[model samples]
Target: MTARTDGGAAAEPSSGTGRSSSVRRTGRWQGVAAVALLAVAIGVLAKRPPLLLVGAVAGAYTAYPRLTATSDPDLSVRREIDPASPADGERVSVRTTITNEGDAPIADVRIVDGVPAMLSVSDGSPRCATSLLPGGEATISYELRARPGRHVFQPVTALCRDASGSVEVETSIAAASAFECEAAVPDVPLRAPSGHHPGPLVTDEGGEGLEFHSVEEYQRGDPASRIDWRRYARTGELTSMTFRTERLAEVVVCVDARPESYRAADATEPHAVALAADAAGRIGDALFDANHRVGLAGFGRRVCVLPTRGGRDHAGRFHRRLATDPAFGLNPPEPARAAEREGGGAPPRSVTGDGRNGDGADADGTVSIDAQLSRIRAEIGADTQVVLISPLCDDEASRIAQRFESGGTAVTVVSPDVTTAETAGGRLARLERSHRLSGLRNAGVPVVDWTPDQPLGAAMTAIGGRSR
Candidate 1:
């Protein structure tokens, strides 16, 4: 059978090709009545026993369907998904078994298992048409490609019909399983720091390296090669040469998964929330490679936070959180208060605590800006530099940047410009977004206004080439 992807469960099923041939009130009873009456009249007038019998049969056939029509169908369905939480672009198999619990035999049975709207079925079909007797069962299996996000399977739609095709029972039942794709955390390339910490990054600082930084009085345990032999010979004093320091910094990749930030000029294109995730992962990977301790945080369904740490294991933990975590895998923003009124909506709230500050986030993902800032200030370390990925539509990013700078922590605003100036409203929105970026720069926070047309690495490189 050809597998199909439905946009989602429909309020009414007759809208698509999976249409049912429901019973119609076309007055077929009138035709049956006319035939029965004609036969009865002929039998009485002509005194024919054959005509009388024919009339009786006609009457019984017409009434039998209505009498046997089933108003209530007794049935149960159980669904299962293998590898319920699959990675992005992975395929998953779904199976559903429906059992007939009624006493009578159902001649025609049609079932449609609710599928995730974001997934596309690659093999088999969720729908099946079959007949089942009392205690009999039927099963359906299908395969679907997994997308990045949490998906809630809808209820099952079942239609049962009697043998005469005259009676049918239609009802929906809850499914046994749900599918989810967690946040896919990735590595990101972050700026290096100067410290005597164990890391792969080679920076311009006085520590251990080949490049000379400065010379100081020789200390114990100094390698002979590090000693400035010419200076020692000339001055008859032991002196050591300091080289660049290879160190790691506490880097946090902050993603603005806010519903308002997830938009695009074209509906067909992926939203900015998705882009931010991609950048976060790749950048985190690069930073980790350089031995930088990478962390992750975001504002979506809730505040998601991971502390700064460095290791291969830590990288895997970050990816798992980004891919499967509800805070990162939520759907795009709906047309709600969260999108329209973001300042009062969810801000940069930390995820570790009670969603603290008493400004609880709404179910749709909006939090108070002050509460978010307070949470950030408390949750993150003082030495950590925040790499913020957002659309910069609201003043939230600017405010956060200002606060971080005031606290002596460097902040970079990498905004994915998703606005189009094709219309008056579009032009106005673009102007406002640019203004927000300008304000951040004025506040000493370097901003990278990135457009979606180019790769994220290029935009980041542009920001990196400048002195901070």
Candidate 2:
């Protein structure tokens, strides 16, 4: 949470006393001069009364009000943001209400609402300028370019000045409020699976997966078709068919949220790590809706690994994890010797650890990319498909994809390529990006090169089509 206080002016008693003393001293001197002039004028007025009148005018000017003005603008602002689920690049409206609870009327009131770094102002402005009377209320509305994850709002400022203009005061509203707007994940409808588990799992009843595994003596309410005619003929008794138990596929989505991979090429932009997390959430939701088990794992500075489970509760868990995870830079760990052995294109040497180095042994230090992929593969069944979401910035990610393929687990990569040829800084950066793209393609990994400048779904579809 971020807070700031500004714009209240306090009058020092010593300073005020000193100023009053000076004024009093000057007034006494002027009074003495006026008395002297008045005495001289009284003597001269014996001959002329006009001079005595001038002395009285001067004395009246000295006795006029010596007014000192000071204003204190005490403002309090509270904001409540709603509709916490907004999609990437989507427009979200933020409503801010300002109340003047102070005694002074605030003039030239300008407010700056703190927006999330990931969000951009694509349409309306976040700053507002207005005037508020005491006990009056003002409302401001603006649109923000929503990005995935939680964002905090900053405090509102109030500027007020006194009527005399001699004193000016700026005050920040106390009791500031904050609300989080979670960006929604984009999802594509999933195709229904062919099999099911019979005990409490959702499925299309009477399907091919429901096979008759046993038969028992027929009882009341048994369907005629379920009756075993052969058993009835042999034993002269009616029997009912029992179906086999059905089970749904359990899916676990493991996302790479390490600091190195989290940062975008343009540091000002939304991090790729957040994008990958959004995609994972979308996929997880789709699977959950289909009655398939879904799980989430975020590997970064602090690993947030969740166990695989099914139902609406699990989906909520996954969403919460994705919304609060911290963003990391795009550096991945070094590749293993096995990655080199199973060759495709030469891996780039630019990739390195995110400041903190990982030990060669998986248990001794942080889990390397290879070990994580292996662990994920081992946890799921052979038929389970592992959807790896990453920016593909390093050799380790490619190696993991290859390992998953070789391990008989179907691997589909959703690569969010933050690199752009239009503004790659220099020729060297552009060349490096080209080489990385080539290497990823050579590995036969289904790569989705998503750019911040374009729509993610369209880019992924284009890549998916070309791969086919």
- List the candidate 1 regions with Cα displacement exceeding 4 Å: 1-189, 192-196, 214-224, 230-240, 336-367, 466-468
Q: How far is each candidate from the true structure, as Cα RMSD in Å?
A: 12.9, 18.8
Any runs in candidate 2 off by more than 4 Å, and if so which? 1-77, 80-114, 123-142, 146-249, 265-267, 325-378, 426-438, 452-455, 460-468
5-77 per-residue lDDT for model 2 (tens digits): 3221211111110000000111323454567477557858586666666666666545442242333444544
Worst 10 residues of 1 by lDDT: 347-356
- On lDDT, the candidate that comes out on top is 1
- lDDT accuracy of residue 190 in candidate 1: 42
Residue-by-residue lDDT tens digits, candidate 1, 1-468: 111222222211121122212343323355776798899999999999999999998998788677766645566665667776788767788877777777877788888776653355678877788988887989898987776555556556676666666655555555434666653433233445423565665566687866678999999999998899999889999999898776667888888876567666653344677667766776677777767788888865467788888899999998888765555643554463245336522211111112222344455345655565566657778778888888886776676667777877778778888788887887888999989988887876777777755555666677666221
Among these predicted structures, which one has the highest TM-score? 1
Instruction: Kindly give the number of clashing pairs for every candidate.
Output: 23, 18
